[model samples]
Target: MEKHLNIPISADEIRDLKVGESVLLSGIMITGRDAVHKWIHDTFIDKTKPATQEDLDTLSQLKPILDGGLIYHCGPVVSGLETKQYRFVAAGPTTSIREEPYQGDVIHFLNLRGVIGKGGMGPKTLKACHDAPAVYFHAIGGAAALIAESVTEVIGVHKLEFGIPEAIWVIKVKDLPVIVTMDSHNASLHTSVRDQSKSILNRLIEG
Candidate 1:
């Protein structure tokens, strides 16, 4: 069945998704990469003067922008800097496994319901998805320009100090295609494929 998921999707909606299911997502999603993730993790971890309240307040303000929000692992090529108007030229998924160390904590802290990225995350993120009622959507690789077509507008940005590629870009999308590779129910198509492939290889070796 085809599912069209709206941004800020409710926990119930996410929980209902199954691995290998295709979804056309619309609404707002934030783009973040390695630097952004690290910054978020570092900012929240500083016990001495950690500005957690400030960060939480920022997310609070953004919550309405996307209720069941999605975080995208991407570094987009943006144009129109002279006019201070940003246009997405290309936006593609980054390797999700690179953020595995901090993804779980970020998802929990930010109350994010979905993640769009390439490759699959590890046990920590998988466990976090189940506990936080979140899911992982795998975007098509080598489809940067194609994916950018879905980005209707750039709403806002955070942490520009990290540079454009690493900054958190708030973008509105329409009918962006993705696959539910990992679901809130702790089901993972990535893991299933890997295990199945391994088993097949073992059988061939034995034969």
Candidate 2:
């Protein structure tokens, strides 16, 4: 049976998932990448410099959007600039490793349940998935248009000053295909794959 995940997913839902399960996601997902991740971390978590009340307000506004939602690591190609009726030309997963340092903290802070991206994350994220009751979904890389076809609408956006790609994009989608690479139980298909590859390489070298 094909698994389908909906937005505002619960901890129980995340816990039910297992690594390597194919899932089709329905409902809303927010697009964000390196900059968005860093901004959230720096503004809220790090506090190297005290954030202004304005910054705090901005974060507050975004919090509800993120709670129990999915974050997509993607920078989409968009059309309809002049008409202001935007359409996704190409939307594919970005390399998720770049957000590794921030993802766990973001998920915990925002109560995020799912993340969609290309390359899998590491120990930190696996631990966070277990801790936060979340999962990481691996969308197929390089199938931009195919993936975009599933997106039903561009609901809204934020941080447009960061430019289109870097800005946070809210999109509605139906049955967007992904694989559960990391699950709420702290299992990681990515780690397994990497370990197996290393073992194979070592054996070949010894021969």
Candidate 3:
């Protein structure tokens, strides 16, 4: 049977999803890369000073904005020239494995229910998926031009001082398309691929 999920999904939710299936996502996804994660961990979610409503809202909108939303893990290109917009605009998915170390925490920190990126996340994040039942989805890589069009709005930004790659951009999107590679119920193509490869290796060694 098909299962429906709520915002800030747990690992349990992801486990049930199948490869190449569709899901309706809702809620916030905080954008970050290596330096950004370090900045956020050092400055926000892990801080002693509590984040104010504005502090949180500056870069994040609540459920109405994200209710049935999906987050794309992308670092975009900056026009870098003097123009109306002097920051990054066109974005492409980053190698998600780079985020394995912090993906789960970021998900939990933002109360995010869905994650979209390339190459997939690792164990901690996979475990987080299991715990939250949130599915990690994937989209065709190198398709940013088509992808950015999906962004309905640039609601706000956080830590703009971090500049470019390290800043958090909160984007609103609709009718985005992606494949379900990782589901909250504890299934993963990464694991299935590894398991099959290992079996082949075992057979080779036995022969």
Candidate 4:
């Protein structure tokens, strides 16, 4: 049987992936943005506080949680207690490019193999896709309620100090279907469509 992970995979698997294949991701996905990225690198990577080697391992391996996985460009809603098993309200995509600065480093460091979002990522992330063989998956934007269903569980959270909208959340999900908007071969649908449109426009003008 094909092993389909539920959601939020692990760091190691993300590094080893292909261009056009589907996966059912499972495990814990950490939600964050520019602020959270800065926070993680500064605090977690730098060991701002004392942490055991195992803790550091988990921290660095964060992105692979989505390896052969999905990355929601979302900032989720925190409507429950901070206990171990609290489910949040709605989690959806935030602009992915804001992560450009750290996405490459994060993917490189954690072996990120996939990402899902509304507006796709930027150049650095694109290069990372080439270097890392990752794919940028596009999820249905504005479908917060539907998206929530894919999330089977909320394992917990981290760095709540960054606060909501920019915190590192541990979210678990399953059987999430997304489109391959970008691929490891450095192919981009957005650019392809744009070029096709431009060609059609020029042809019409010449005729």
Best candidate (score: lDDT): 2
- Comparing 2 with 3 on TM-score, the higher-scoring candidate is 2
Q: How many residue pairs clash in each candidate?
A: 2, 0, 27, 15
Evaluated against the true structure, the overall lDDT of model 4 is: 0.66
Which of candidates 3 and 4 is the stronger one according to lDDT?
Answer: 4
Candidate 4, run of 10 with poorest lDDT: 10-19
lDDT, candidate 4, at 129: 80
Residue lDDT tens for model 1, 1-207: 779988878989988998989999998888988987787778764433366675777656665664568889999999986776999999989999999999998888878897899998888999999999899999998799999999999988877778888988999999998999999888888888899999999999998
Error of 2 at 195 (Å): 0.6
lDDT of 3 by residue, 99-166 (tens): 77777776666555667888887788877776755667876688877666655556556666776655
lDDT of each: 0.87, 0.89, 0.64, 0.66
Question: Candidate 1: where are CA atoms >4 Å away?
Answer: 45-49, 52-67, 202-207
Screening candidate 1 with a backbone cut-off below 3 angstroms (N, C-alpha, C), the clashing residue pairs are 8-67, 8-68
Question: By TM-score, how accurate is candidate 4?
Answer: 0.73
Candidate 1 structure lDDT: 0.87
Off by over 4 Å in 3: 1-16, 23-30, 45-70, 78-89, 198-207
TM-score of each prediction: 0.89, 0.95, 0.71, 0.73
